[model samples]
Target: MSREQVVELIPALRAFARILCPQPENADDLVQETLIKAIANLNQYTEGTRLKSWLFTIMRNTFNTRYRKREREVIGLPPDSTNTLVTQPDQEWSARAKEVYSALMRLPDQYREILVLIVIQGESYEDAAVICDCAVGTVKSRLNRARQRLREELGEAVED
Candidate 1:
């Protein structure tokens, strides 16, 4: 892919990175690392392949690698820090967003990743399957099950 084409994909790449990472700075680092790797490995990218899917695969792999590394060297916050971090609800939307994000975090990685791709990021099932390295049918099944789980977690009635 050309540099200009890669530039065009930045917004979508950043959004995907954000979904994988909770911290803004970490998400930014992931995006930067993704772009660097893409640029360095540009020759491997075949022409006519989906560029967005390619970038997303790189981002996901990068996140997985970093997540595993961090898991080995985990850090702990000070004991009293948790109490200090609690905030009174300043707005309804923010509170709701927190609840939804918390629920999303509780899901299995497979379900959460697929849900973010298809439901939150608005990617079609085919495209999501490509990014996720799964079959289209698998993406559909996971998305359906993920939605059902989310509904249960949020106390919403599941329709047959």
Candidate 2:
């Protein structure tokens, strides 16, 4: 793929990164890092495949690596200190959105990732499977479970 093509995907990459990282600055950093990695390893990318999926794979891997490293290096912050980072929602919609986002954040990584990839990002099952390195059936199963879990979290009635 051409560099310009990759550049065009920055907005999409930023959106995905925001979902993965939450904090805007961190999301921007993740997108930048993804672009750098994609550029550096451009030769490894196969032609005639979805560049978005390939870049997503790289971003997912990068985020996972950073998460693992952070887990190991995590330091306990003063309990009250966290409150400083949270901003109170002003509007009703904002509050509801924050609630939904919080529920999403509470989901397990795999479930959350699947939901974001399929439900939020509008990725096809086949594309999501490729990005996630899983079978299509696995993607469907995870999506089902993720929806069920989200409904449960949101206090919606779930059908069997």
Candidate 3:
């Protein structure tokens, strides 16, 4: 991929990386690593395949690798529960966004990743499914389940 193409995709990569990693520095590193990877593996990418999809796939794999590393160092963190919020907003928005964020963080990695790709990152379901390596129908079903579980966790407060 040309430098220009990589530059154009940086913002999207940033968005995805930011969601995957909490710190700005960490997110930047993740994006940087992803860029290096995408470039290095450029020849392996199929011409007709989506570049953005490939980029996201790299980001996801990188995030999982990092998470595993972190997990080995410490194990006290609660397993990401579908009911925990992943939304964030220490100020403004309300505690709800943070609550939502926590719930999102708690969700199963598969469901949470799809939610971010489709809902937070605004990628198409097809793109999300492609990046997620699942069928479109599976993506839809997971999204439905994620939303339902999140709503159930928030209960009536989410409706207000």
Candidate 4:
């Protein structure tokens, strides 16, 4: 694909990157880096595949690589960091949200990725399966397991 075509797809790429990277700045950087890589390796792209799918695959791979690298480099926050302060108006809701988020974080990467792709990002099972390079059944199974794990972590009773 040409650079202009890639440029036109930036909005969609940014949306996907936003969910992949919680930080807005990091999402922007990921999108930029993905575009650069796409342009650089344009020759490797197959003509039959959808460009959006190809681009999402590249973005996902780029995010995964960056996440692995960042995992090795940890910067500790000082005790007085503003993030330590409670700024929420509704402390009850905030606490519950934090608890759920913590539970979500505890799930395995495969489960978490599927949940994020299907539930959070509103992608269909087929689309998520394509993005994850798995079958639709695998996506459904992972999502079900992820939800069960989250419930277990949160101490919620599992229901059929």
User: Would you list the C-alpha lDDT of every candidate in the order shown?
Assistant: 0.78, 0.80, 0.75, 0.75
Clashes of 4: 0
Tens-place lDDT digits, model 4, residues 1-160: 6678888889888877755654455778899999988988889999877787788888888988785355223212354665323221235567788787667656787898788776766677887888888999999999999989999999989985
Q: Which stretches of candidate 2 lie over 4 Å from their true place?
A: 71-78, 83-93
Residue-level lDDT of model 3, residues 1-160, one tens digit each, is 5678778988999988866765555678899999998889888888777778889999888878775355323333455742222223345656778788667767776777788888767789998987878899999999988887787666634542
- Stretches of candidate 1 exceeding 4 Å from the true structure: 68-92
Relative to the unseen true structure, what is the C-alpha lDDT of residue 77 in candidate 3, on a scale of 0 to 100?
43
List TM-scores for all candidates, in order: 0.81, 0.85, 0.76, 0.66
Better of 1 and 2 by lDDT: 2
Candidates arranged by lDDT, highest first? 2, 1, 3, 4
* Model 2 C-alpha lDDT versus the unseen true structure: 0.80
- Sorting all predicted structures by TM-score, with the top scorer first, yields 2, 1, 3, 4
Best by lDDT: 2
**Each model's Cα RMSD:** 3.6, 2.9, 5.1, 4.6
Model 3 lDDT, full chain set: 0.75
Candidate 1 similarity to native, TM-score: 0.81
Candidate 2 lands at a TM-score of 0.85
lDDT of 1 by residue, 86-153 (tens): 22122456767777766876787789999988776778899899888889999999998899888888
